[model samples]
Target: MTATTQPLHGRVDPAALPRHVSLADTVGQTMTMAWRATLKMRRNFEQFFDVTIQPLLFTAMFAGIFGGAISGSVDNYLPLLIPGLIGQTVLTACVATGTQLREDMDKGVFDRFKVLPISRIAPLAGPMVADMIRYFIAATLTFATGIAMGYRPGGGVVGVAAAILLAIVAGWSLAWIFTWFGTVGSSAQAVQGISLMVMFPLTFLSNAFVPTDTMPGWLQAFADINPVSHIISAIRDLANDGAVTAEVGWALLGCLAVIAIFAPLSVRGFTKKM
Candidate 1:
C-alpha cells in the first residue's frame, strides 16, 4: 500500500482509531470498571458498614423510638417505617458514590483512564454500577430486619420485590448527582460534607419517618413535594398495599429526570478534568 494510505514507519493512521467508543464497547468498559470497583470493596471491607450494619441498627432503633408515639406499637409501625427506611438507606448509601469518586481522583486513579481509549463515563459509572449491590443489600436487610421485628408487609413477596427494585433504580439514578459533585468538588471531604448536607434534608424533611399530615402546613407542603416522599409513598403503596399507585409512576419519572440531568453533567464535568 502507498505511504499515504498506510501508516508511515509504523505510525498509526489517525483514521484507524475510533473517534468514539461504541455503545457495546462502552458497556463492556463500564462493566470492567465495575469489576475493579468490586475488588476495591472487597479489599476495603469496611466499605460495607452502611449496608451491612446500618440496616440492623436503624430498623430496630427507629421502630422502638417512634413506634409507640406514632402508631401505638412497634409492630404497627413496621409497615410504614420499613418502606420509609428502605428509601432512606438506599439514598444514603449512594452518597458514598461521590465521596469515593472524589477519593479516587484525589489519589490520581482516574488519570490512569486518560491513557486508555474508553468511554468517558465508564470510570464514573462503573463504581456506581457496583454500588447497586450496596443498595440491594441495604434494602434487603432493612426488609429482613423489619420482618424479624414483627413487621409484615401486606404487599407480600411480589410487592416487596418490586419496591426493592425501585429502590435500587432510585439509588443508581440519584448517585449521578453525587458523581457530578465528585467531579466538581475540591476534595473528598468536601464532597462528603456537601453530600451529607444535601442528603440529610432530603431524607429527614420528607415523609420518611412520619406521616406528612403530622407536620405543620408549610412543612407538609415541602414533604408532599419532596421527591423522597414520593419514593417512600411509592414503596409504601407497593409493599404495604400491593398497589402500583400514581406515586410509583411519579417516583420513577423523577428518577428518570434526575438521570437525564445529572448523567450529562457528570460526564461533562469528568471529561473536562480529563
Candidate 2:
C-alpha cells in the first residue's frame, strides 16, 4: 500500500469547514471582542459621570443661547432644536472612537494585541463597539434636557424611542469613518485634529442650527444635500411631528451605507498596517 501524503499541520481549508463553524470561528469571535470592549465601558462606572454631564451642558448651553437668538423661546425651539442637539451629540461621539484608538495605540495596548491569535479586525471593532455607550448617554441626556425644557414629542413614546434608536445607529455607523482614520493616521494628535476638521464642516454646514433656507444661495444648496441634514430632518420628523416619512427611510439607508463603505476600509487599513 502506498503511503498517503500528509497535509500541512495547523492548516485547514475554509471552504471545507462547516458554515456554522466558520461563522462561529470568525464572525462570532469578532463580535465577542466587540462585546468585551462594550463591557469595559459598562464596568467603569465613573466614566459615565463625565459622559452624562457634558452632553447635558451642551444641550442646555446651546438651547439657551440659540433659542434666544433665533426663535426667542427655549420651549418653542425645543421641538426644532432638540433634533439638532441629537445630531450634534452623534457627531461629537464619532470623535471619541478615533481618540480612544490613538490612546490605545500610544499606550502600546494594540501592540500587545497584535501578538494574539485574535482577528485582525478586533482592535478597530472594539473601539467602535465601545462608543455605543457614549452615543446612548449623549442621546439620552439630550432628549431628557429637551423634555425638561418643555419639549414634547407629538409621536408619543414609540416615536421618541424610534428617534433615539435612529440616532444611535447613525452615531455607530459614523464611528466607522473615524475608526478608519484613527487606524491609519500617523499619530494620535493627527487623528484628533483630523476628526475635528471633518466633523466641524459636516455639523456646521447642515441644518442643525438655523434653517437651511436662511443661508446664502450656494451654501443652502449644499446643506440641502448633506446627509447630516437628512438625519436631522429624520430625527425632527420622528421626535417632533411623529411622522415617519420617506426622508427617515433615506436617512437610515444613508447611515447603513456609510457603515458598509467605511467598515471594510477600516479593516483593510488595519490589516495593511500589520
Candidate 3:
C-alpha cells in the first residue's frame, strides 16, 4: 500500500501520495491491523465482557422477566427470546466498534496509523475483522444460555449454527455505520451516546420480544420495516423452523446495503479526519 498522508487542512491529497497500492500489500496490512486490534482486545479483556457476560445476563433476565408475561412460560419464550437476544446482543456488540474507534482516535492511535504506509481502510476494517470474534462469542453464548434455560431449537445444531453465522455477518456490516460515527463524532462518549440512540429504537421497536400483532398499528408499521425485525425473523426461521426463509435473504441484503453505503463513507470520513 502506498504511504499516504492527510493534507494539513483537508482531505488526503492524492497528488502527494503514490498512485497505487498493490492488492496483496493491502490485504496483508489489513490483517496486520486486525492483529493490532486483537492485541488491544487482549490488553483490555473487558472488551470481551459485553459479548461474554451480556448474553448470559440478558438471556436470563429477559427470559425471567418476560417469559411468563410474553409467552406464558420461560421454556415457551425461548423459541422467541433466544433468537431475539441473538440479534440484540450482536447489535449491542457492534456499537462498541464505533465507540472504541473514537476512543482510539482521541488517543492518537489512528494518527500513527495515518503516517504508516498502510491502507486507509486497514485501520478501520481490521478492527472490524477482529470484532467478528466478539460477534461470534455473543451469538454462541446467547444460544448456550438459552439451551441451559431449557430452550431447545427445533432447527437443531445446523440451523443454530447458521443463525450464529448470520448474526456475525450482520454485526460486522452494522459496525461500519458506527465506524462512520467514530470518524465524525467529537468524542468517544458522544459517539457512544448517539450509537445507542439509534440502536435502542431499532432493537425495541422490532419483533425482538413480541410479535408485531400485539403492537399498535403505527408501531407495527415501523416494526415491519425494521432491519432488526428481518434479522430476528431470519434467525427464527433458521433456528426454530430450520428453514432458509425469505427473511434471511432480506436481512443479508440489508447487511450488504449497509456495507456498500457505510464502508466508503467510513473510509472517506477517516481519510478526511486524517
Q: Best lDDT goes to which candidate?
A: 3
Candidate 1 C-alpha lDDT tens digits along 49-100: 9998999999999999999999999988899899889988988888989999
Candidate 3 segments whose C-alpha is farther than 4 A from its true place: 1-14
Writing each residue's lDDT as its tens digit, candidate 2 over 45-128 gives: 754654577668877888889887888888777887888878877887788777777777777776655545556666677666
Higher-ranked by TM-score: 1 or 2: 1
What TM-score does each of the candidates earn? 0.93, 0.86, 0.93
Which wins on lDDT, candidate 2 or candidate 3? 3
Clashing pairs in 1: none
Give the whole-model CA lDDT for all candidates, comma-separated: 0.91, 0.80, 0.92
lDDT of 3: 0.92
lDDT of 1 at 233: 94
Estimate the overall C-alpha local distance difference test score of candidate 1.
0.91
lDDT by residue (32-138, candidate 3, tens digit) is: 99999999899999999999999999999999999999899999999999989989999898899999999988988887666556677889999999999999999
Which residue pairs overlap in candidate 2's backbone?
A: none
